[model samples]
Target: MSVTRRSLLAAGAVAFSGALGPLFASGRARASAHGYGPLLPDPGGLLDLPAGFSYRVLSRAGDPLRSGEGTVPSHCDGMAAFGAGGGRVRLVRNHENRADAALRVPAVDGLTYDPGALGGCTVLELDPGGGLAAERVGLAGTAVNCAGGRTPWNTWLSCEETEDRAGASGYARDHGYVFEVDPADPHRLGAVPLTAMGRFAHEAVAVDPYRGVVYETEDAFVRPFGLFYRFLPARPLGGPGSLRAGGVLEALRVPGVPDLSVVDRPGAEFPVEWVRVPDPSAAGTPIRFQDFGPGGITHAQKLEGCYWGGTGVYFVSSYARGSEGAAADHHGQVWSYDPRRGRLRLEVRFGPAADVRLPGDSPDNICLAPDGGLMVCEDGGGEQYVFGVTPAGEVYPVARNAQDIGGPGAPAWGEFAGVTFSPDARTMYVNAYTPGTTFAVTGPWR
Candidate 1:
């Protein structure tokens, strides 16, 4: 059943009517209705899927492309697809290298940045049959092209997930902002870094069309924990391409945790609320939602991947370390935020036993399957694999990196980072970051 905003508001009101402090205790009733265990495999790698489904490499990093560009760079991260002129598909992919080494590219048309550091974006046009026909640099000269999302207006928002401004001389021009790119006309659009979105380590973005809101996640790993942010457009129902126009940025805050005496689990659901971050430009703003999980007084884990799926927004915590006195459960977690239901709920938690365990604790990008399932890319482990979870909570391996898992020239099958399905849902495209390669897989899902 599709839930409406009004129904969610009513549910929220009932949850908060008695006492906001125990709202989650009452929310348990709702969780029971949607609970499911993670489908990842165990540590020894015994997890396997049905025989029919398989994957193949479409393109890879360092692979000599038809474009004059010498070779694709390492660290292929976020990506998005758009329909092209001749029934083909255009893919805008990011290279997350922040080191002071020049990225080798045959041509520099869509490239940006200085010569020393190797980081930027690339656009590849794939023919209807899933063959790479043309390629070019999309946005060059950026640092750490982490993970970003697709815009509703047929564009890709590539986010730089770093806060380093060493080369900026004082103010960073584009260190930690989302860049808008047109995959169709890669050279025509000058890279416009959206600074008003806030200067933090952004992991991924999920736009809410109904509310005209862009939900973003911060991958802050320093002193303060990361924050879950929402960018409310000044106007109602604005186009996704206009995200750079500016909006209100707010942080998530769990009520009442000042004395350091309160005990709560980080995974425990709470009556969380959105608190405005008076000035996104101000780096001194206090974090609103801090320390509320299993590890008593824990902070928000590094939120990496997110997608809009089945009546809610699904998010993932790459890993959550235990706090002061709690047991450390480095396993990643997936949460659901039902805007229409006005409630944020925990859906699945993956530990060491799942089919695609996060042995290295780096869960990066995720995409929803057409059949109400999820496809996840593992960023940390030595053996990178694309894992899928069925709606029934069954986990299976869809693809594995055939090359090295990390660093340049890594195995393509070991480091799958981004996964997306074609509009028809008949084909799936997966990309590996370091040894940049995008592959198209088509088969019947048994």
Candidate 2:
């Protein structure tokens, strides 16, 4: 079964897959000139990009979808791009809205899962020239639809970032599960949560195509922080609905490294192991709180964007501050895990310096660029930007969020999300978190 956006809403479920892409531009002179060079301000005052590049606002919140059933939702978060054949493309987007939000995803009949919840996903089909062709809601009525991963079989794993349970805060069913959205078929009705994937403050997931294992990250920030997880599904490469069959959820343990925040140096390597989570459902308590022997499972703060690349999975730790009760402080960190060798390596660390302009701190959604580098989205305070990081750890700004949503004196900087490239690597698609807007960027991509 394939899962493309249009196919999912019109039929039932369909599947499609494509590689994900860049991130924070560093303040270094050399890094600044590496990618497309300095960002040329956008006269429209929305997104600022380099000289040869241009962007178009494909869709915005409140705009009527092509289906005419409802309008585009707010707080667009994680997204993936898939080829729609005939040189066209389709995008599966997530809306991270809460139940109380003024603008919520419309609960279309049969397509919605929860009547009281207000988060889900929207699908946009772009023409070969990067023009909007069609738009519709692919999934609906899920809470806090946050970052998720793209399956090798071409389906999107839309994750609920909240752990709100049934009978709590107007919720009718338990949240915090991964729901698969097929962009290839549009006929499926009702959303089914993948319970075997575990229930926590889910952030993002990365699928190991070879082993058919799904790795997940938790973004919970409390006394226990969050734990990295891996779901060993019952059926490997079984396509859509396979994950629902069941799986064993386990947490990563970096031996003696109880807290990931303490690791400041890049290139740090540690042998790792996975401990089975006693309760993947988190029926009574969260998976992170459960006992994992004396050694315990390793934890990190703000565990966010995850993607599969190279020999393993690459995940991000947005930022850590000692004042916030973390072990050590750092602007940001990117770690890569090589499952083949059972080893974890920290590839990038923002700094010992407090400068946000240096490496663009608090990096959020990330992807491996077509140019063999990494592209990252910044979610920190002040001006937000999408940056690119070369294999050498050098950074350059790919795009900047120049949207003046606050009017006059108050300039609002909305963080960029859902950074992914087309299958042909000719166009880039991204989202602005607030005053939701999806941009289709085309330029001289090197």
Candidate 3:
């Protein structure tokens, strides 16, 4: 039942290739020329791109910094780039750690968190040529920063993806929430968590400007499925500093499908919508029980990477199957939600079962290339790798951690997580968590 890019395109043509199909429906489109073959080995131990591609390591974990900050933490997760004054690039990166272990905050003046485990968030200024200009800690004392989206006003929303209410230690209030950090500010902003965004295991956030809606995904890997949530800002264009004010939170529920079980073979045309769910922690709530599966399902999956491109919001589900039951339908799905058309459709699927055999389910963040293709971070095995897929649905490896610096097992940090392009779309920057490093790469494609 695995679907390949070629097969998916064929299916789309037969099912809805009219005016509704993707813009790249016809193979004659310019997207066809952007095709990239599989990865080839390079003698320099760097990513081997097509004839015109080249890469350079910009920043590495434990590397000395002019900011006087100590060593960068391992587990680098989500990140966002901004245009700094004087045509420099500012990047805000998140360190996903629960604070339960040793805290590795750099020695920056205003950077360290209280519990020490407030994972690291650093704002580094880079030159247009991909050189580090300046660096500072954006926020500190946050826990398990999984993934977050960038604000149109030039800020990064770093999310703490944890809900450890009761454990060996006591409960930490407001631990699982989203924090807004200003890359330009050397000191931490307000350190305020947007409670209105709902308290859950958040994986990533995607903002829709046209609808003024913020789409978010949960990463509950334990019991219930993760849930897809949408936050409606009380005011349109809540501006840059209005996230903590208030908003409405709603979950996703497929109507007409009673049993609501995960669909293993969800058709490309499966319909979905944002459904309101009662807050589990509501005061007057009397009964509480464990509810898994699709119907009466309280959550969705560990949705990792998300991006707004090609006239829609593209999101990925890191975990396709849970111990509760068989995977709903497919493993690692790329879904496109067109706000204008008010519809959601499956664009591609990845995993061992899919036609294209990817490394594993450890898909982290994603970015659309200037050539109109998709770049993915493979976070599964310790042998982390980055993948690039063409519009024609060709998947190939772009980079791998063969240098042995990432260590044995592919720990969360230091693994390749976030991928973004320069403002001119001529350069690509990739970051890893464990060893904490950022690589600047340029190729013929640019």
The lDDT values for all models are 0.60, 0.81, 0.62
State how far residue 142 of model 3 sits from its true place (Å). Answer: 0.1
Between candidates 2 and 3, the one scoring higher on lDDT is: 2
Better of 1 and 2 by lDDT: 2
lDDT of 3 by residue, 277-349 (tens): 4663322321112232355533445677877775678777765554554346344666667777666666665
lDDT of 3 at 351: 48
TM-score-wise, the better of 2 and 3 is 2
How well does candidate 1 score on lDDT at residue 8? 28
Number of the candidate with higher TM-score, 1 or 3: 3
Candidate 2 lDDT (Cα, 0 to 1): 0.81
Candidate RMSDs in order: 10.0, 9.0, 5.6
Ranking by lDDT: 2, 3, 1
lDDT of 2 at 98: 89
Best candidate, TM-score-wise?
A: 2
The runs of at least 3 residues in candidate 1 whose Cα sits more than 4 Å from the true structure, single-residue gaps closed, are 1-50, 101-117, 166-174, 235-237, 256-269, 282-298, 323-328, 352-361, 405-414
Candidate 3: residue 289 Cα off by (Å): 7.2
Total clashes for model 2 = 36
Q: Which 10 consecutive positions of candidate 2 have the poorest summed lDDT?
A: 11-20
Error of 2 at 85 (Å): 0.8
> What lDDT score goes with residue 364 in model 1?
69
